[model samples]
Target: MPKRLTLTEAQQQMLDLPAELTNEPIIITKDGQPVMAAMSYEHLTSLLETLEILSDTEFAEKLRESMAQADRGETISWEDAQKQLGQ
Candidate 1:
């Protein structure tokens, strides 16, 4: 479960909370309404790494399709490509 703290209480406990619950997320609230959250650097990095892996998988699938088209002679040669680019 996420730890809950009022805005004022969060300000008071911010320093200690980081160390006390380094593996969990803390939810901060204003006027009893949820506003923001604080999580450990490790957790944030793990989330970013997962997102990168997912993006790479998508890119790889697209690259495979392009390669298949090229192998089937559906792609232009480098010289032709250069001419098309007016290079």
Candidate 2:
């Protein structure tokens, strides 16, 4: 579960969170209602990238098709791929 903090507590302890805390966001609440989240820049960047991919209609369609193919066992083996690439 993520850490929760009130607005006042967030303001006071935002900078006190450990640097290694990256997996979960800090939930900021006002009057006990969640109003905001704080996460590492790296996590934000990753989320933005995922959103970008999801928003690209053509790419997302292709990705879905690829996943379906994978589910249907249409992929080649790693050795075959290496050989095809002359690696």
Tens-digit lDDT track of model 2 for 57-82: 99999999999999999999999999
Which stretches of model 2 miss by more than 4 angstroms?
18-20, 85-87
Model 1: lDDT to the true structure: 0.86
What local lDDT does model 2 show for residue 31?
94
RMSD of each: 10.8, 2.1
Compute the lDDT of residue 34 as modeled in candidate 1: 93
Instruction: For model 2, give the RMSD to the true fold.
Output: 2.1
Clashing pairs in 1: none
- Give the 10-residue window scoring lowest on summed lDDT in candidate 1: 14-23
lDDT of 1 at 49: 89
Candidate 1 lDDT, tens digit per residue, 1-87? 888999899899978877956778888999999999888888889989877875897787887899899899898889999999999
Residue 27 in model 1: lDDT: 89
Q: How close is candidate 2 to the true structure, as a TM-score?
A: 0.79
Task: Give the alpha-carbon lDDT of every model.
Answer: 0.86, 0.88
